[model samples]
Target: MTSNSTTYEGGCTCRQVRYRMTAKPLFVHCCHCRWCQRETGTAFALNAMIEADRVELLSGEPEPVMTPSASGRGQKIWRCPTCRIAVWSNYGSAGDAVRFVRVGSLDEPDRLPPDIHIFTSSKQPWVVLPEGAPAVTEYYDTKKTWPAESLARREALRAKRS
Candidate 1:
């Protein structure tokens, strides 16, 4: 992690599932997919994509909730059983090893902002995406996707900017 890159500390509602991410996020996003809406019990879900290795579990283990994805894949949502708050999710494919952390569940939720708005086609009409954000009407994207090297580069850039 770069010096200027912020270290984020967060946990579930009851603080039973604490976590720390040493590096800056790969990307932040507001997803408006139907699954997100049902799962989050909100119009959308705020997510911070980060390298799996950089995230450390500081406390209790999260209970897993398995659900089907839009692509017919399985998604395992990890949550704090005490608070029943979804903290992170793992995509089913063995080839993909990243976990999507729920940004809102963090201790410092404001450390990051949604840089992109995804699944806009399912977005609620009343909710307008912030101006200048990258918006997509469908599933799967590249602009907000993070590769390891790119993530490291972004961390460096963040340090320089800070």
Candidate 2:
């Protein structure tokens, strides 16, 4: 919305759902939590945290499927009806205002690397975090980890949330 040029386009595996991130994300998270590993069937889940309003739908709509989370607060996973591939999710804390876009679903996932690695305590033994990459045993306080610009963006989004 602020004349951002870094846009990312992506979609589901079946191409049933297409979307574009209008601006850079607030922050990216590479979660190694057990829930993430189980849900993604992989070692981790890379998510680009962004304001929901910044995500523009380009094609089909994604159906929101309510799913259980480790916090027991539940999460709404938005997936393509045709492929059933999750594109993003709305967590209970963020409500429907924020979206955790699956980085793997992006057309150029490598363009947005994880800003931080979370829940590393549950990370797979075979996966060794890069030397210098920010890794935390659990979640982190955004005030301490995120950049000032990102924190400001988050604050703006927070005002918009109901």
Candidate 3:
């Protein structure tokens, strides 16, 4: 979704898991893998990939579930206990350094639509991708192709770190 500002707010079904994203997403992706299908109980998973530092929890905490990773380690997944809605996840390898928020849980549900699809090899045969949408058999990092505005924000952050 297009907006004048980068910030967006979201919460769980019961509104008990409010959160604020302080910046625009670095990238958006649609995951068609079986794992995502089963987890979301949908055809695909839409994610607004953002900097972990830009996400803030503004309400109640979510219950944590640690699921084993593809490499056998565990990753912490946070969800709303009442709705069992997956709110966010702390990717295992980085040990809670980065997170992937479930864009469906956002208050502005229409704000971020997937511009690309990941794990297309596992997509259901009946599901057709949109014309001109980029698809990949596996994951693609966004750093190489972030939109101009987001790239500038990332560079500014990097400069601050240095």
Candidate 4:
């Protein structure tokens, strides 16, 4: 767990937009799905999942671009207008309540490592996962994988939905 004083700052490539994370991410995911590869133009997409309330804008506003996803509901990618760098995404499941932050956009990308690797069935053969890291062929059950606090937080969100 990150200390309360520990904050993360990040911005777009052109530095047109800036944001801050007040707390540690609830979880980080290294997704190797084909859709992720096509969107990121890379082997995988490293995303740090956090509540939208935790992300505070410090500078320029990012534009949300709707993009197709494997889930069919699509996702809204928040990107810097000038640099066109994707800072984060809001999936349909949680809408804007949660943000899937692009870890690569972080000032200290190495600070938060992937808590789990998903969609490994389609992963490139050469990309090796770290030993002992939690990995699965597809998405895992949140009840079985997510931390207790995260589950509780999700429950609270669900309660609000109802």
Candidate 5:
């Protein structure tokens, strides 16, 4: 949430796969959906959303593994081939244009905390969201929640598709 550097570096558990983000993330999500719980083997998943183009591989290449998701279309999780640690994922909605980077995979994960908590309808009963934190029962409208700069960036990307 608070960092002096625009760029951030991270990699797999073994440190074999390294990558850098050229810019700060557009947004961060604390997802509590059942699918996320199952995939992460935890109560929730912390993901930093950003444009895929901004992610640069500094060392090892990640293998994109096809995986099932709440959406039938599925997603591709880019993981370190050797350590098998998932670094990021490309969902069906944005394809490869956007990446949901696993904050846990970051060297300084604390630098980017969840901007919003999503899919709380299916969240575990034991889990309690922070007081006054932005949360929603399901996915949010990016136009309403995303920062102005991020919204403009997204709009520009959409314009290119047209």
Candidate 6:
């Protein structure tokens, strides 16, 4: 488990849009849905889900690009204007309350591994998950899967929005 003080800094490939995560993310997801694979052009998209307030932009601004999503509600993918590298995404369900930071964009991407793998039903046949990694065909209930601290943090954020 990561400490609350843990911080991470990252940027786009061109270094035009730098940012920092002030604390550990609420959760990390490795999504293997077809939409993710096509969007990222990879087997999966690894994201660190955290409160939007925790992400601090340190450099150039990222332009939000509206994109179609599996939910059909769509999502906003923040990408660097220079390199057009996706840095993060704000899903329609969570709106602006949360940001799914791209794990691959981090300076030390390996530090935050996926807490769980979702949409594994559509995962590429060639990709193999770790022995003990938490995974599900679709999604998991946050109440049952999320750590207590993360749940509390999410509740606090919700309270603020009220």
Count of backbone clashes, every candidate in sequence: 1, 0, 1, 0, 1, 0
Best candidate according to TM-score: 6
| Candidate 5, residue 135: how far the Cα is off, in Å | 0.4
RMSD of 3: 3.2
Evaluation by lDDT, superior candidate among 2 and 3 = 2
Model 3 / residue 77 / CA error / Å? 1.5
lDDT score, candidate 1, position 113: 82
* Per-model TM values vs. the true structure: 0.82, 0.95, 0.82, 0.94, 0.95, 0.96
Clashing pairs in 3: 10-107
Sorting all predicted structures by TM-score, with the top scorer first, yields 6, 2, 5, 4, 1, 3
On lDDT, who's better, 4 or 6?
6
Q: Order the numbered candidates by lDDT, best leading.
A: 6, 2, 4, 5, 1, 3
lDDT of 3 by residue, 1-162 (tens): 225477888878888888888877877778897777877789988877676788898988889997765656766778987887788876665455456778888877787888789999999999998888888898776675567886777677566656
Candidate 3, poorest ten consecutive residues by summed lDDT: 90-99
Q: Counting only residues 3 or more apart in sequence or on different chains, how many pairs clash (N, Cα, C under 3 Å) in candidate 5?
A: 1
**Whole-model Cα lDDT of every candidate shown, in order:** 0.78, 0.92, 0.78, 0.91, 0.91, 0.95
Q: Give the per-residue Cα lDDT of candidate 3 at 102.
A: 84
lDDT of 1 by residue, 33-150 (tens): 9988988889998988765777899999989888888778888888898988888887765212466889987777877888778899999999977787778897555534656665
Off by over 4 Å in 3: 1-4, 141-143, 147-162
Which regions of candidate 4 are displaced past 4 Å? 1-5
Error of 6 at 38 (Å): 0.9
Which one wins on lDDT?
Answer: 6
Local error of candidate 1 at 67, Å? 0.9
The true-versus-predicted C-alpha distance at residue 117 of model 5, in Å, is 0.3
